[model samples]
Target: MATYDLKGKRALITGGASGIGLGAVQAFLRCGASVAVNDLADDRLTAVVDELASAGHAVVAAPGDVGNPEQAPAMVAQAIAALGGLDYLVNNAGTPGTARPIATDDFERQDEDFWQLLVNVNLVGPHRCTRAAAEALRATGGAIVNTTSIAAFRGGGSSAVYCATKAGLVSLTREWARALAPQVRVNAIAPGLVDSDWMCRFDGQDDAVRMGQPVPLGRTGTPTDYGEAILFLAAGAAYVTGQTLNVDGGLTT
Candidate 1:
């Protein structure tokens, strides 16, 4: 946990209600940056923002569904306005569309709706947010950090569609770096198995003990692990862009 002098800085993190996104929200606040937390309009969003505000951290609730074409840009605009400007945009919203992993050969299960849902949230959603926040980011010379997945690189994921969408995001990250250069830098992180409460759950399997066994580090990653990397890319990493860092506890190695 390196300390960054993020005082007076402002950031908006999508999917900020829980898991890695929540971790990122805390990271930014700890470094003295005002944050606008975005998620679907839900009770968790209210509670998280209220809790941070009560703690005297400058936090705002900017709730909306990134999958929605209209709400995504509107939410980013409103968040940027609320923050007075933006220094960082973390495009962390995404979905696996399943409580358990769908077998790769389960073609019948990998239907049209499943593919579309993954694409909408995991791929197009980031594009929507980045595009909406581009001008503000450019003005401030801010950076964008996208939450991709180790699933983008290899075979193990909830489904084929989920992996494909994340891979698409990797491509977008590179293009966005070029599109916003000399003003804003863009990068991504591909997380390995993480011990977080999200839509993707392993029934009767302990993520730390089961999934951790395969990781070279012999542990599943916590939100803090990925969060630290997110913070670095957003506030630091001046010379880094058009890249995807593997925050996977050496799993990729």
Candidate 2:
């Protein structure tokens, strides 16, 4: 239905050069949205921007480290300028955090730096982006769809920090939803195990095996699965906010 149509809407998606973020970018474009894609990788950003621009899509690359407190605001400003305004934001950046259980003595024996790195990237990163984008979203009556993970609801992912930060994101979604109020809608998606190159970072010996060992789904999810749900939250879920939709193939249940 046209209720879900996002034609002419402007979107800012973090980590849009690859993985789940890139998948959301494609779906948004198909729904007729102008997009500004953000990522830390300059080359990947350029390539994605060029490809989409060539196809006559209003897409631009906003290259900056989201984990950098200063860079987040700058990236948001650039997205506003490039896309003319912002209507939707997909906060999809994430870090699996070296792919190890935090309970392991080896992981705990590492150092504080490891934990801080995870917090900065997995937690503060999205906070910075959302803070920077909040004003723009409010002005346009926009929506913010944060990409969390099933790790937020379950304890079986990367490490203590990753899961904790994702859970924090879920809390942020609920708080921002009420704070932004009848203006900018804030929500989140907590996806199950997604089959992407990012998964390669976990259990390097065999990514396939690790992914397949997940819940009733019998297999891992695809980026598109999460991407479509993102689109729904951004455009279709008009009456929804302060909720974290779990796209985990019924994993949590």
The models' CA-based lDDT, in order, is: 0.91, 0.83
List, residue by residue over 111-152, the lDDT tens digit for candidate 2: 788778878887888888888888888889999999988888
| TM-score for each of the candidates | 0.97, 0.91
Poorly placed runs, candidate 2 (over 4 Å): 1-3, 99-107, 203-206
Q: What's the CA error at residue 156 for candidate 1, in Å? A: 1.7
Give per-residue CA lDDT, model 1, range 1-253, as digits (tens).
8999999999999999999999999999999999999999999999999999999999999999999999999999999999999999999999888866666556577889889998999999999999999999999999999999998898665688888899999999999999999899999999998887652366544644576877888888888888889999988899999999999989889
Clashing pairs in 1: none
**Could you give me the TM-score of model 2 versus the true structure?**
0.91
Residue 118 of model 1, lDDT score: 88
| Model 1 deviation from the true structure expressed as Cα RMSD, one decimal place | 1.3
What local lDDT score does residue 71 receive in model 1, on the 0 to 100 scale? 100
lDDT of 2 at 152: 81
